[model samples]
Target chain A: MFGLIGRMRASPGKRDELVALLLDGTEAMPGCLSYVVARDPVDADTIWITEVWTDEQSHKASLDLPRVQATIAKARPIIAGFDSQTRTEPVGGVGL
Target chain B: MFGLIGRMRASPGKRDELVALLLDGTEAMPGCLSYVVARDPVDADTIWITEVWTDEQSHKASLDLPRVQATIAKARPIIAGFDSQTRTEPVGGVGL
Candidate 1:
């Protein structure tokens, strides 16, 4: 499994725009399985995205997509900070 | 808003027990707003918890509670890796 869990700090007065881009851009990527952007109930500028893709290759390809790249281009300065970490885990759990 | 976002890597054979403890203990936290334990659909060893509390005081107290602490003591080696990060954000979202 491939996933991206991270936070994006949007620029002043730009949270809505970034969220819009994400919501709209994500729909265009078939490789994307599940993508959720949850804004902090208290912090308007903070956005947390939990994204899952089919595999590492799909994740890489999604990033290279025109829509994804375009969204990033439109996001630049409006974003204060962006950081993420990726991990892969095996299927099914045995521990109980 | 106060929230705890982190991953808990359960021991090779202890994921169920840990999850049970969390599920049971969280219900006892009056300060808790929301507590969700999501296991990686792909990784059985991975557990992600998104917990929101009233404040730092509540969060700390919850940990000090008998059940919560007892759960931890019983969880030790059963957990392979545990790490977490904390942050606070003001409420309401303006950006759109």
Candidate 2:
């Protein structure tokens, strides 16, 4: 499995809105096993997104998807910057 | 629940060793729901550690555990530096 751990920083007061935007329409994507958008307890302006996909290609393909493209466009405005992003290979877990 | 997404970079050519160190003796931790250790596909020397604990306190308490502390000590040497660290509140998920 492929895993992505990314931290997105929002405009000073736009964290909640960004989280909601990220959550909307994330489901039903092909090969997506888990998609989680969570509130960062330490950083008020940050959101931690953890995703598990069947493979790296599936995740790459999803970006070209229209729904995702639109969501990304909507989120772009509120996003302040990306704090960090990392890619990983998920070996196994309870959720997998 | 509490979520932690941390990226640990290993010294040059030591990624695999670091991953093994992090994984050893991780199980049996109290209140730990899911713990995933993954290799960063994009970065050769980075490891992404994703964790879900019952609560913030449980996660904090785990650090003081003898086993965990020992693991930390073992891992400390090969560790390069933290790329990113973020704390999150997991709303709900298939795993939890």
> Chain A structural similarity (TM-score) per candidate?
0.82, 0.95
Tens digits of per-residue lDDT for model 2, A6-91? 77899999988888777774756788876777887778898878888899899999998888899899999999999877677976
**Top lDDT model:** 2
* Per-residue lDDT over B1-96 for candidate 2, one digit per residue giving the tens place of the 0 to 100 score: 888888789999999888887777476788987787888887889888888888989889888999889989998898999988767897654344
Worst 10 residues of 2 chain A by lDDT: A87-96
Residue A66 of model 1, lDDT score: 89
lDDT of 2 at B87: 75
- Runs in model 1 with CA error above 4 Å? A83-96, B1-6, B9-46, B49-96
Expressed between 0 and 1, the share of native interface contacts present in candidate 1 is 0.03
Give the alpha carbon lDDT tens digit for every residue of A1-96 in model 1. Answer: 465567788887788878777776666575555455666566778887655555768878887888888878887768899766545332221111
